[model samples]
Target chain A: MNEQLAFTIEVFLNGLMAGVLYALVALGFVLIYKASGIFNYAQGVMALFAAMTLVGIQNGQVPFAHLINAIFGTDVHKFGWHVHSFAAILLTVIVMIALAWMVQQFVFKHLVGQEPIILFMATIGLAYFLEGVADLMWGSELKALNVCASEGNCLPQGMNVWLEGTTYEALGYGFFIDNLDIVASIVAAVLVAGLVIFAQYTKQGRAMRAVADDHQAALSVGVSLNFIWVLVWSLAGFVALVAGIMWGAKSGVQFSLSLIALKALPVLMLGGFTSIPGAIIGGLIIGVGEKLFEFLIGAPFLGGATENWFAYMLALVFLVFRPQGLFGEKIIERV
Target chain B: MLDDAKQADAQVDNVLEVNNIEVIYNHVILVLKGVSLNVPKGGITALLGGNGAGKTTTLKAISGLLASERGEVTKGSIKYRGQDIQHADPAETVKQGVVQVMEGRHCFEHLTIEENLMTGAYTRTDGNAAIAADLELVYNYFPRLKERRKSQAGYTSGGEQQMCAVGRALMSKPETILLDEPSMGLAPQLVEQIFDIVKSINEQEGVTFLLAEQNTNVALRFAHYGYILESGRVVMDGPAKDLRENQDVKEFYLGMSDEGRKSFRDVRSYRRRKRWLS
Candidate 1:
């Protein structure tokens, strides 16, 4: 009924929307970490690369054009053609699959049976190498990813006018909500449901979980570790692409987009790295906690911008109480 | 050196032939030094040894699981039905019908009992009906597993986990199972129950078994043939009946001498004077 209440409700709704996006990214991390125990520092970069690749393919830009032009003294960038967004997305997925295969074959295959810390260090190296390769392939420039069909069907931007007018008429105050955020929430829900079904029912999905539980045991049962790892990486890549398209559309495809992973770290800490539902719930908690804190106390008492650090602070406090995370398997002790 | 009576039993077609295999761990530590054995088809062959005597290492070598632990069969060969499988991967070995149930019951702890059994059928290309039939067969063998099928394996007791491991392996329809220390950490009664299941599985399913165990008395009882290993080498090999009657095995392994039940103090000194080792 009041302006403050309406604004608070608006913030809460926006926080849920943001949490969905965080969960999208967190899904990628959980998939890879669950299967192989690799933290996959490259996940965020994989998103950036997928988004950039999608844009490049849609624009018909030649891969490594700059390097080729510099070497051969030929000026050729694009083929002067555009690809349909749907076709470009399909091509990007294929490319992501190939990248998954190459990563497993060239990098991780030899690193099998190595320590977790060693595998983690390898992923760190892979992240930097992949980031550099993506920049070289697509050129480091801001690009707009257009997934919409046309002007009428385009991803609607700006505040929802209908919501604002309706809320104003009902409560004597307007609520702000972005149409893009609503779309993101729906997409994230569908993605999560699909993942849960696949994991719960399918043969390969069961194998993935088996591998996650015990690699040696899974192998003994005839589960191919290499195939499972590649499958997991490809799934992670697909999730990353979905996340990439969402974030890239929100703010043009840029280097800073990868920093979204830094935000997801606190989410993982809160959710536990081994859980999917924990990720979603943790993301929601972090998102709402930060937004509410910024609104109530951050602006009025503390200097504004507590939103930047609030999630981490909350996650740190949460870790003190529940280190295994909300949904993590409890470590059982036997005397 | 085979005796006349036991030599005739060795004529059965060997399902698995592990010949003079030397396993090296981390490329330096020699674990299995030219260990050799033969597992007759449809019989339970036991590898009996003490701690660190390379029983588990030999099983891992045959099952192609040693590579995962940074242990490699660096010398000799392992043949399953005349096919060389020393370098085959673990998955390939499983496909070839050789599955190793690792020691300490390495069940997928997070998975439910049924889900863990299903994972054993991962490599099978047959339809779900076949897998379901096998699931029922496994449950019949391990009804306790069926009762706790929905419970997570981590919460299961030690004996139950051991049974779950064997049942899970059985779901793979394996020809030969390399069971490593199934008796470890189980009560004596539970160990007897597990050995009974292994005997029944061997008789009913016609599956070959190369079980590595430290309980020489029980292992000798269930096994048709037995090999004794000391410091990674096969010290003695014979039919289980003859092995049970061997004077050296009785004194050293079964912990009984012709004189009487030897005390641990005298046995410790007598172990150093092993005639077989000399």
Candidate 2:
């Protein structure tokens, strides 16, 4: 294959990898939205905090003798837990769940029947608080993670399979697809499927749907608002933990990991806030589509960083045609 | 005929007894001030009042919706089937077979008619087959809903939506249904049709009804017992027939002249008391 075409394919593959991560973050947003009708601005921070907590529990901070002596009167990094990646992941999930429960019991429960804007602002407050807590708990340093499977080896390492007298490379050029990426993709797909089944078939799923449809009607039917809120938040927290593990494994766990949540906004915008399938499909489209666009057309004109705004632009264009979303129901206004 | 008469007489026992419930909203404003009423096991009891006279508040208190926001039933108890249900959750109340068809029909507009009906059986732990059977029974009462079963409730006309709401409530298999303003915002023809359906529901299905209504003429005509609420107080209480003929009821509600009031009272009271005793 020619160099130009290879580069295009390479960018496309890379975009798909990043898109999967974005979709993971977006899934967290969708779960919380479905149950509580609030767009959680803190979701990104939840992901960051989970990632940081995992790092802190797995590998202790760098030895700074003066600061450690000043703070704990000893070298604290030497007394680190050094837990396994898998165990750390599980522990992080538990911590996230506890945080979720606390958020619902303390913040959300009191804010019931408040205006939507007020609730949204409260999530913004939660985001800042969580970010500060994460920094204080783990320090503001980046920590690298060992891949759950293996480090320094992509899934398919430069294998070419011949088909019909032509040799087609299994992996793209210049950017080898890591087995970890493939695993992340598979995990994301499985999570999405599980969430879909839970939302459709389970009794709690029906209650969640009822709550999403109308809060007053759900309350009238005797659905506990506080319980459902906590359930959804915990579910969202699990999603954050999963996303944190994958992203932390791929790119070092740090405060910047929270920035990934910003990408999910456009995903939500394109898919509509209430849809689960919308999040998955919209994620894949943004992932695969933007990379290809950036590699081929973007380099020729707009230069680089096309992937940054590609999803938002596509979503904006789509909004002009279908304002609610590709999958969103059209809202009718009654005077 | 004798057995049926005996059964009817036994069923006349009070199914619901409300004893002096006082409801305060936002902890200060008293909506229901020591109000009490009783509904028999197998007929209509009309709660008649003007707007804001606590008719809707009384119905809501029974359903558990009004109590969610700390709207304390300060002074009395509500007995359903001889058990205190004043503090029961809405779902528990529904499961106990006392379903409230809320005012304005509160149909789940985004849901299909069939889905709306399914929600009524939300608290039922019965098998899907039993639920399906109940659905058929509900559709039999309001066939129009069955025809538009797959259609979203938002698209249905006002009268059809009312039918769907009532039909959905019936899907729960409640022994007693509380209806709040079932006649509101409908044409006179549709109102007559709804009242006729309510009568059939009571007569044929043996379901009891406590209906709150503003149309005093029609309410008194259809009800077996009636209470006239004026400014959150029951000013007059008697059998429906007696209330229809009472001088006070005629002047305040029936729009009858005062010249005929004095002569009607004794005859009306005696006839009403005789019907009650029989």
Best by TM-score: 1
- Writing each residue's lDDT as its tens digit, candidate 2 over B1-278 gives 65355445745688899998898887898888788998878878999977898998888788777765656677799999899988887778888888888888877777778877777777778899999999999988898888999887878888998998788788788898889999999999999999999999999999999999999989998988888786666767877877899876676567675665546577557545644553
| Displacement of the residue A175 alpha carbon in candidate 2, Å | 6.2
DockQ, per model, reads 0.72, 0.24
Q: RMSD (Cα, Å) of candidate 2?
A: 6.9
Could you give candidate 1's per-residue lDDT for residues B1-278 as a string of tens digits?
45443445544678899999999999999999898898887888989989999998998898888888889989999999999999999889898899999999999988899999999888788889999999999999889999999998988999989999999898888999999999999999999999999999988999889989999999999998899998888989988888999998988888787798877887777676673455
Give one digit per residue, the lDDT tens place, for model 2 in A1-335: 57776766766777787788888899899889877878899998898888888777666444343465677876555444466666767878888879988999889877776678999999999999999888767778788866444432322333311111222355444545665676688899998888878866676776776677766566555566767788899889989988887898888888888888888888877877777877876777788888888777887888778987888899898888877776664563333
Clashing pairs in 2: A155-A178, A155-A179
Query: What does the lDDT come to for candidate 1?
Result: 0.88
Tens digit per residue, CA lDDT, model 1, A121-148? 9988988898899999999999887666
Candidate 1, DockQ score (0 to 1)? 0.72
Q: How well does each candidate superpose onto the true structure, as a TM-score?
A: 0.95, 0.79
Evaluate chain B of model 2: give its TM-score: 0.88
Give the per-residue Cα lDDT of candidate 1 at B163: 91
